[model samples]
Target: MEILRVKEILNEKGWRNKDLADKIGTSENSVSAIVTGKKFPKPETLVKIADVLDIDIRELFNPSKSVDLQEIFTKDENGNLKSVGFIKK
Candidate 1:
């Protein structure tokens, strides 16, 4: 999720961060965090976000990519997985 995308969506809907915060019962800072990906909202928050944006949750998390199992379960020397390859059986 890109901040630019969210900004575009908001602009298209003629909504401001403060307006969305009021509608969702959250603070402008929280909304900003979500838009910037500094924080991921919970399920309920996501619901509110979707409602405010008039978009489906599925749209928020578009699933068009192929599954990559290795990305789901692998780690490097630093204990941080590169998460790039498909699953190796």
Candidate 2:
């Protein structure tokens, strides 16, 4: 889905996962997992990714599925999106 788009963006920018991770202050593995769809980025981190890649967040939405952008990014009472089941190391 959007993983393809991310890869395309990276290629277009002559960058790689490590480059993206470095630019956004995240681990390369995190970015790799994200690109491979093995994990999802935190909503805030996703925003950073969109900014780094110079794309709209909507562009990252997977078109093949029923992606509820609002629900996925909805803030909790603590003002943080609920965990997407992975943790930052």
Candidate 3:
């Protein structure tokens, strides 16, 4: 489960979803899902988003929510697959 205040951060920074989408080379709909907590981005995408937003990647995570680390990745931050409504595919 995700708990990042992505939308809030975007608002605080005055960034539209289109801005994020453009920065990441993805569609606005994909960015919207992540912003709304309807989906999680791929790790690489997450890194890109964090960079674009000028935030730590950890800032996008919900520290209070505990998702199994094993279920999240196969190798490392840049590796294999684990998805839930990940729209950028």
Candidate 4:
């Protein structure tokens, strides 16, 4: 993940690490680690960061390749195909 991109966004928004940490309910050190690529945040934390930045979660973890809907459904551990969302053509 290009965590520096997040830092750049914060800088552009005139926000400090502490400000972001407070907004995301995390510590400044944790935010620093994330920004420096020393750690990865949990999904919930990623969502929180995206919400605070007014960006989509996909912007943070941009998938490099197209997802195969059929593969995803076929790999379902529970074999519950109905649980899968719409398959992209």
- When 1 and 2 are scored with TM-score, the better candidate is 2
Candidates 2 and 3, the one with greater TM-score: 3
CA-only RMSD, every prediction: 12.9, 12.9, 13.0, 9.4
Colliding pairs, model 4: none
**In candidate 4, how many Å is residue 29 off?**
0.1
Q: What local lDDT does model 2 show for residue 36?
A: 82
Q: What digit string (tens of lDDT, one per residue) describes model 1 on residues 1-89?
A: 35235656778788898998999999999989877778878989888788878898666664466564544547788998666556644
lDDT tens digits, residue span 1-89, model 2:
44446766788789999999998998999988888878878889989989988899878765665543432345788898774553323
The candidate scoring highest on TM-score is 3
Is 1 or 4 the stronger prediction by TM-score?
Answer: 4
**lDDT agreement with native, every candidate:** 0.75, 0.78, 0.81, 0.79
lDDT computed for candidate 1: 0.75
Please give, for residues 1-89, the per-residue lDDT of candidate 3 as tens digits.
55777888889899999998999999999999988888888889988989988998888766784444422233447775655332222
Top-down lDDT ranking: 3, 4, 2, 1
Ranking by TM-score: 3, 4, 2, 1
Worst 10 residues of 2 by lDDT: 65-74
Worst 10 residues of 3 by lDDT: 67-76
For model 4, how does the per-residue alpha-carbon lDDT over 16-45 read when each residue is reduced to its tens digit? 989999999989999999887888888899
Which pairs of residues clash in candidate 1, taking residues 3 or more apart in a chain or in different chains? none
